[model samples]
Target: MKAEAERRGYQKKMEAEKEREKPKPLSEKILLQNDVIFACKDIARNSLNYPDSFEVENTNSGIDNQNGKQIYYFTLDYSGVNAFNVRGTHTIECYGTIGDLSHSVTHKIFN
Candidate 1:
């Protein structure tokens, strides 16, 4: 009975995963920090749209910047992203792939 319940849960999880959308193309944007690693297999940065100085790579795993600190990670399965640095102003767009999925991230940097 327990095994059967687990099987059902697994099936539901797989179904939900299949519903995730593919990523989009890349765009231009402003990033505030250096060595910003977007650790994701599904997501990749579009090199053609970016400059040669910007370094982008695919990691087998996710971001590992946090050291012994509690951090929250949110998995986004979509085509667009709207991120704000300070809140209440500005817009910037960046793009990458999420596996075979392509998506864009809009980040705002403020000082």
Candidate 2:
């Protein structure tokens, strides 16, 4: 019985996911620090599982300081992302793939 219930739940989840992927007229503005702009319709889907991703290179000093990594990590609060309303702090406590690949900070975001 548990297995059957799980299957039904999985089906519903899949349908909901498909519904989300349906394209719609873009709306909503994402505000980020510095000169970079993050729009809701701009990012890509995370193939592993994350709905999307926002990468930043910390090259603040225009000219590379010879050995500086060239970019810095920032935070983004994207909790309010969805079909209805695209605005709110995200549930993201951190960023990156599975298994402690590497830890990094993030910049906040809005819908």
The TM-scores, one per candidate, come to: 0.20, 0.23
**Weakest 10 consecutive residues, lDDT, candidate 2?**
27-36
Q: What is the lDDT of residue 109 in candidate 1?
A: 24
Deviation from native of the Cα of residue 13 in model 1, angstroms? 0.1
Predicted candidate 1 versus true structure: per-residue lDDT over 1-111, tens digit per residue: 999999999999998787665454443211211112343212322221222222222112232234553222223222221243222221222223332122333332221
| RMSD of every prediction | 17.4, 18.6
Off by over 4 Å in 1: 22-111
Off by over 4 Å in 2: 26-111
* Each model's lDDT: 0.31, 0.35
Top lDDT: which candidate number? 2
